[model samples]
Target: MKDKTIDYLLRATWIAVAKMYNEEASKKGSTMATGFALLNIDPEEGTPSTSLGPKMGMEATSLSRTLRSMEDKGLIVRKKNPEDGRSVLIQLTDFGKEMRIFSKQVVLKFDEAVHREINQEDLDTFSRVAQTIMDLINNKKIYKKQIPSK
Candidate 1:
């Protein structure tokens, strides 16, 4: 399409990337979100249940569902945090550690392929543009009311 909007491009690119990851995850009997969560968890120290949502950019409901699925699959275990009695810590099982390594390799492979395909200058510009967009949104400059009428 001609004159594609920035948001359209961003959304389309994300959807494409998500689809690719989903396909890969399916081969492992898992979802992309599950792989992502696995990657975020600290293999040795474990991660807090409350922090997983923010780390994964997931909603509480979605994170809870994913955590439950992982638990059922024997990929993760939950333990009460000794420091904070009210909080729970999430640790991966031995199987989960193996899966985490696989997930890491997949991510690294993607990065390698992208770097091979895209030149450094272009990648740098893309990174800068993406960061700017995130900053604008984070600062509330992208709010509907804040955007000037075109």
Candidate 2:
């Protein structure tokens, strides 16, 4: 397309960010997804397995696979939720806590860089625009259902 659309820019930016994160994570023998999951899980109080999926905006299958990999790497352990017998809690191992700190630093570094480069007003505008887009999608305002008359 000759003209770029909002989605194009959003997707391209996200892809670039993901690639940059993946590169940094690779040095630590991890992936962007793993780092993301680590950040989302509560350090003190473990998060529910079912909640992790919605919280991370990931599908169950993908989250399951990532959890499995983390488990294999000794990053996390699944324990029965004391309060909810039916649900499992995802708790970080000591090693997982260490990696979570690393992930947090990496994210903070990126945020610092962006703040240093962009002016506050521009950043605020960008944030507002992003939120508006999300609101539109979440509120189902983008596409309306059409009724066909017989």
**Top model by TM-score, which number?**
2
Candidate 2: regions farther than 4 A off:
147-150
Candidate 1, residues 1-150, lDDT tens digits: the string is 679999899999999988998898888998899999999999999999999999889999999999999999999999999889999999999999999998888889999999999999999999999999999998888675655669
Residue pairs with backbone overlap in model 1: none
For 47-134, candidate 2 gives per-residue lDDT tens digits of 9998999999999999999999999999999999999999999999999999999999999999999999999999999999999999
List RMSD in Å for every model shown: 3.2, 1.6
lDDT of each: 0.93, 0.97
The regions of model 1 sitting more than 4 angstroms off are 144-150
- Give the TM-score of each candidate: 0.94, 0.96
lDDT of 1: 0.93
Which residue pairs come into collision in candidate 2? none
**Residue 35 in candidate 2, Cα distance off native in Å:** 0.3
After superposition of all CA atoms, the RMSD between model 1 and the true structure is: 3.2
